[model samples]
Target: MKIKALLAASVAGVMFAGSVLAGTLDDVRARGKLNCIINTGLAGFAAPDDKGNWQGFDVDFCKAVAAAVLGDANKVSYTTATGKTRFTKLAAGEGEILSRNTTWTFSRDVDLAQTFIGVNYYDGQGFMVPKKLGVKSAKELDGASVCIQTGTTTELNLAEFFAGNNMKYNPVPIETNAEAQELYKAGRCDVYTTDASGLYATKMSFDNPEAHVVLPEIVSKEPLGPVVRHGDDQWADIVSWVLRAMMSAEEKGITSKNVKKLAAQDNKDKEINRLLGKDPLQGLSKLGLSADWAVNVISQVGNYAESFERNLYPLTIVRGMNALYKDGGLHYIPPIK
Candidate 1:
């Protein structure tokens, strides 16, 4: 009797999981809006603008997904999540896509039952200190009070880095980037540690950015990307390909200004034509996207390079590892065809 009951439960669970997977695209269409989860506030990544509108690199990625899925870039609702609450909110279904500047890790992908589609930014953990502190290298910061976001890979990385280096430090935990900024600015913490890009962003936000210097050492690899719940391959494809479309658009010299014209004409490059929906690419329909989905993404939200320059340039973030593969960086366009 017990064995029979267990078998029945297993079958029921599979059915439930199947439904959840199949229903994501339908749910987004029926609701007419994409729910995007993002960081609480990280300058140049996922922070609000002067007019109370969310605008940043991650924000542009979310908008691109909305454009691809809903045909309207503005048809997105944003939910801000701190380091501690991000996974819980995503698992609880508070959002359709987690477009936060979240690090892709093993435990997050497997143990948490979340799927990281692909990396949008390749980064490494780094440290920052005020010039007054006179810290040149990460190795110089012994016994420093570090302001770090709680419940993040940064925390574990911090501990491991310090332990490995035979250094001791005090931790100042905060929930959001905004809180960390305030604490660090108020001199509550002697150092700030996070993604190198984040360190640059944080440093740029200060009254005197030159007063703080990001350390020369980069500690851990942080491949940041968008995420979706597991068991949804179709939904995952839609999200993943949206990023791919943007990247390929840049590689093919297709910008927002010219995408519409290119889509209307016959292009010599078959991939460009296929990507712009001038020719059919099999399985776009299977992914529950329109033929012109890539068009919408590039036209409405701009390509990946445009988004990066518009958002991150202000922070002085150089396109080091985030640059295209052809440009001696890590980003590679998965062939659109």
Candidate 2:
């Protein structure tokens, strides 16, 4: 009976695997576009502009994938999802890739059956309070009402922080950043907590930005990046390598402004040559992308550094821990060859 049960489980696994492998590349090709899920709205991450064009750091990653596959960065349909719905949408096959500012956590990585492609933003949970509250530190916020997003690492992190500090506070849980911002502005919550970068973006969106201040406490590591369903190895490789290509492009000093010109330059550096597909970006073509996939990504979306500075710098989120490892931070890419 035990052996029969084991055989049944094996057959079920194989059937599940077969269904998942059923031609995502062909679907994308036939649709002539890539469907990418992004945050409902987060400045410097995945928010749409006044013209309804999606543009931000995360948005660029999606465009990079689209460019690498379809040879056109604009060949993408952006689906906006909140924290509570992003994973469910992705798992339901609502989108090919989710480029929202999602953190890489143990449960989400292993138990949740999702593949975090790479860390595009290294962040931490922080608190933002009204300057008038006279609270200079997160430690002082005992019994305070904190606005937090439900269905996020922030929720767990907030609980751990308060428990560790031996403090009690009211949690005003909301579904989206927009709702949280409203609750915060209405004085419904004493503090708004999320990733440090997200807090900055939210604070800046307020009418009187100077009235709110982000505390210096970073409670949890929130390494935000792209993700996809776990079963598709081909899709995972395509997304993973796109992010790596961007990071490596930044490390190698290849920017969108000069990518075309640089692509025509000599192959003095083998790494650069391999990355730009000037000399076979090595096994990347097997993923159904052109030899110049990296070139297309760099030219269309710019390097990782460029994308960050474009959206994040404006909100005062400097490149501190998010900088490449060679530049004295923790950003590193796997080898192209």
Candidate 3:
């Protein structure tokens, strides 16, 4: 009966693993706060305000998930992680969700055992240089010293772009955006390379922001989004739909200013009613969230447009690829109903 014993032990191990995988929601609920991992300090994406409050495009998504699950957007605790430590912290369960400006890729999704919920920002790698440098294009930087963050897709993209152009340059590797900014400003590197959106954010933080100009060329696509650990289907769905709900709310004209009022009445739009919990939508109970979850998210954090305009607009970041689908952008979301 040795074979029988081995099969029994195997079944027991599977059950234990399933239980662990299924406990993310329960764990958050029990903890009474959602631990969200964010960037150390990437201005428009995730940075502390003068008053030490975390506010940005990525921070809002974490708050939205907190609102949807815990019924309070402010019930989230933030943990700062550098690019090199983000995935390791997530995989180790140090944080429930990683809302840093992380790019989604095949290896991160499959090999690392993590799930990227959806793309919050469509970005591309670009270069920024001082106007005094007189370099208008990235191609002109043949032998330039490029300041790039370590452990990012931008690093790989930079290498490939330079190699493809048959050029060589000195690499000034750094760990954080703030470090890169410091070194670039001190003339340690001739060029600063990162996502185009990030370039704007970095520029805005400078003393004389107008002195720097981002080049026109976008070298590689950077689909940035929120991430969670793999093997938790329920937690993944909850986070995924939290983002989708914000997009759907924007598509349906449900802004934070009017979400509560609209939720009180039965509108002609059945989808709106369903989203605001006037009518029941199936499968939400399985995710262990309330019927008014979408309402909480919309009312607290607002739609995707609101978050972007509030955080990125001040940095002069226009919604190029981040605009709605009907508005000729890539932010199309599936129906909430």
Q: In terms of TM-score, which candidate is strongest?
A: 3
Predictions in order: lDDT: 0.90, 0.88, 0.93
lDDT of 3 by residue, 93-170 (tens): 778999998999999999999999999999999999999989988899999999998878988999999999999999
Root-mean-square deviation of each candidate, in angstroms? 5.5, 5.9, 6.2
> What TM value does model 1 have?
0.93
Clash statistics: count for each candidate: 0, 0, 0
Better of 1 and 3 by lDDT: 3
User: Which scores better on lDDT, 2 or 3?
Assistant: 3
TM-score of each: 0.93, 0.92, 0.94
* Predicted candidate 2 versus true structure: per-residue lDDT over 114-175, tens digit per residue: 99988888999999999999998999999999999887899889999999999999998999
* Model 2, CA-based lDDT: 0.88
Ranking by TM-score: 3, 1, 2
Better of 1 and 2 by lDDT: 1
Looking at candidate 1, what is the lDDT of residue 141? 80
Question: 1 or 2: which has the higher TM-score?
Answer: 1
